[model samples]
Target: MHIAAANREDDLQRLHEQITQTRLAILVTHNEQGLQATHLPVLLDPQQGAKGTLLGHLARANKQWQALAEGAEAMLVFAGADAYVSPGFYPSKLEEPRTVPTWNYVAVHAYGRAEVFHDAERLLDIVSRLSDRHEAGRATPWSVGDAPADYIASMLRAIVGFSLPIERLQGSRKLSQNRSAVDVEGVRAGLANSPDPLDNQLAALMRQP
Candidate 1:
């Protein structure tokens, strides 16, 4: 990712927070046929490696999993809110009309070698933890035990799990940080007033200190 100095976000805590906030990631891998991508709901184990480890699963019927050898290269792309920016929102546009429209977004890229596993026990633990995490705060939370034991076991057999110990992490948050304070305020105001939900989301991120 080509991140401008003003947009670069390398802070460890912030990066992990971004990953946790966006549980679903696009897992990218390559094989003989070509590149393949899967949308995976992953759990991040922050203490497991130099950076951290990502845990996720794919359906057994998915050919993408069949390409995963012992240690295959992979990347997890986590995307946050994004919105379109118009030069009309910038105060500087009056003085310097050369400004053009742009898009603002937040994203994290994780690169590492992936390890695949099919052990029923490990798969069970992974599914159970993911369930508990997402089900929290619901009026009635569901757990893996809610299903019949044999049913759960049978379901687990239809998927494959993988672990990726992150070797590197890159984060970028382009929220008009490069713009002048006055212009940024104008942009935020314009976005906040827009009816689009994504625009409102970007405006909210810009409010962060």
Candidate 2:
């Protein structure tokens, strides 16, 4: 991602927060055929590597995993709240009429070497952890052990696990920080009143100090 200096998010903690908040990520890779992308929920292991490690799984039938080579690099994109910014929302637009529409969003890109594995034990552990992470907040949290032993084994056999040891992390948070104070306030007011919940969420983010 081409992030301007003003929009660049350099805080490692903030980047990690964004990744954890948005568990789903777009994993992209290239092969002889062409580029391919898969959306999956990724778990971060902050203690696993210098930066961090990402764990996720893909269906055994997915051709994307077949393209992975040892030490090959892949990118995982995690997106947070995003909304459209209208030119009318900028106070300067009424003064000079030079303002244009833009988008406000938060995103993080993680680059790492891809490693594919099919170990049943490792795959089961990955699945169990993933399940626990997502199900923790539920009133009736279901677990991998809730299913029959043979059923769980059958399910695990149909998927493959992978890990990506993060080598680089880049983040961008474009929330109208480049605009004038008046324009920023104008945007916040306009988005806050918008009917879309996502717009309201972005407005809240914009108001943060």
lDDT of 2: 0.90
Whole-model lDDT, candidate 1? 0.91
List model 2 lDDT by residue over 39-102, tens digit each: 9998999888888899999998887887665445789999999999999998788669877899
Clashes of each: 0, 0
Question: Which pairs of residues clash in candidate 1, taking residues 3 or more apart in a chain or in different chains?
Answer: none
Tens-digit lDDT string for candidate 1 (1-209): 78999999999889998999996889888988689999989999999997999998999988887666535688889999999999999998989989999999999999998788999999999999999999999999999999999999999999999888999999999999889999999999999999999899899999997
Q: Using Cα atoms with residue i matched to residue i, what is each candidate's TM-score against the true structure?
A: 0.96, 0.95
Give the lDDT of residue 30 in candidate 1: 90
The C-alpha lDDT values of all candidates are: 0.91, 0.90
- Give the C-alpha miss distance for residue 95 in model 1, angstroms: 1.8
Runs of candidate 1 exceeding 4 Å displacement: none
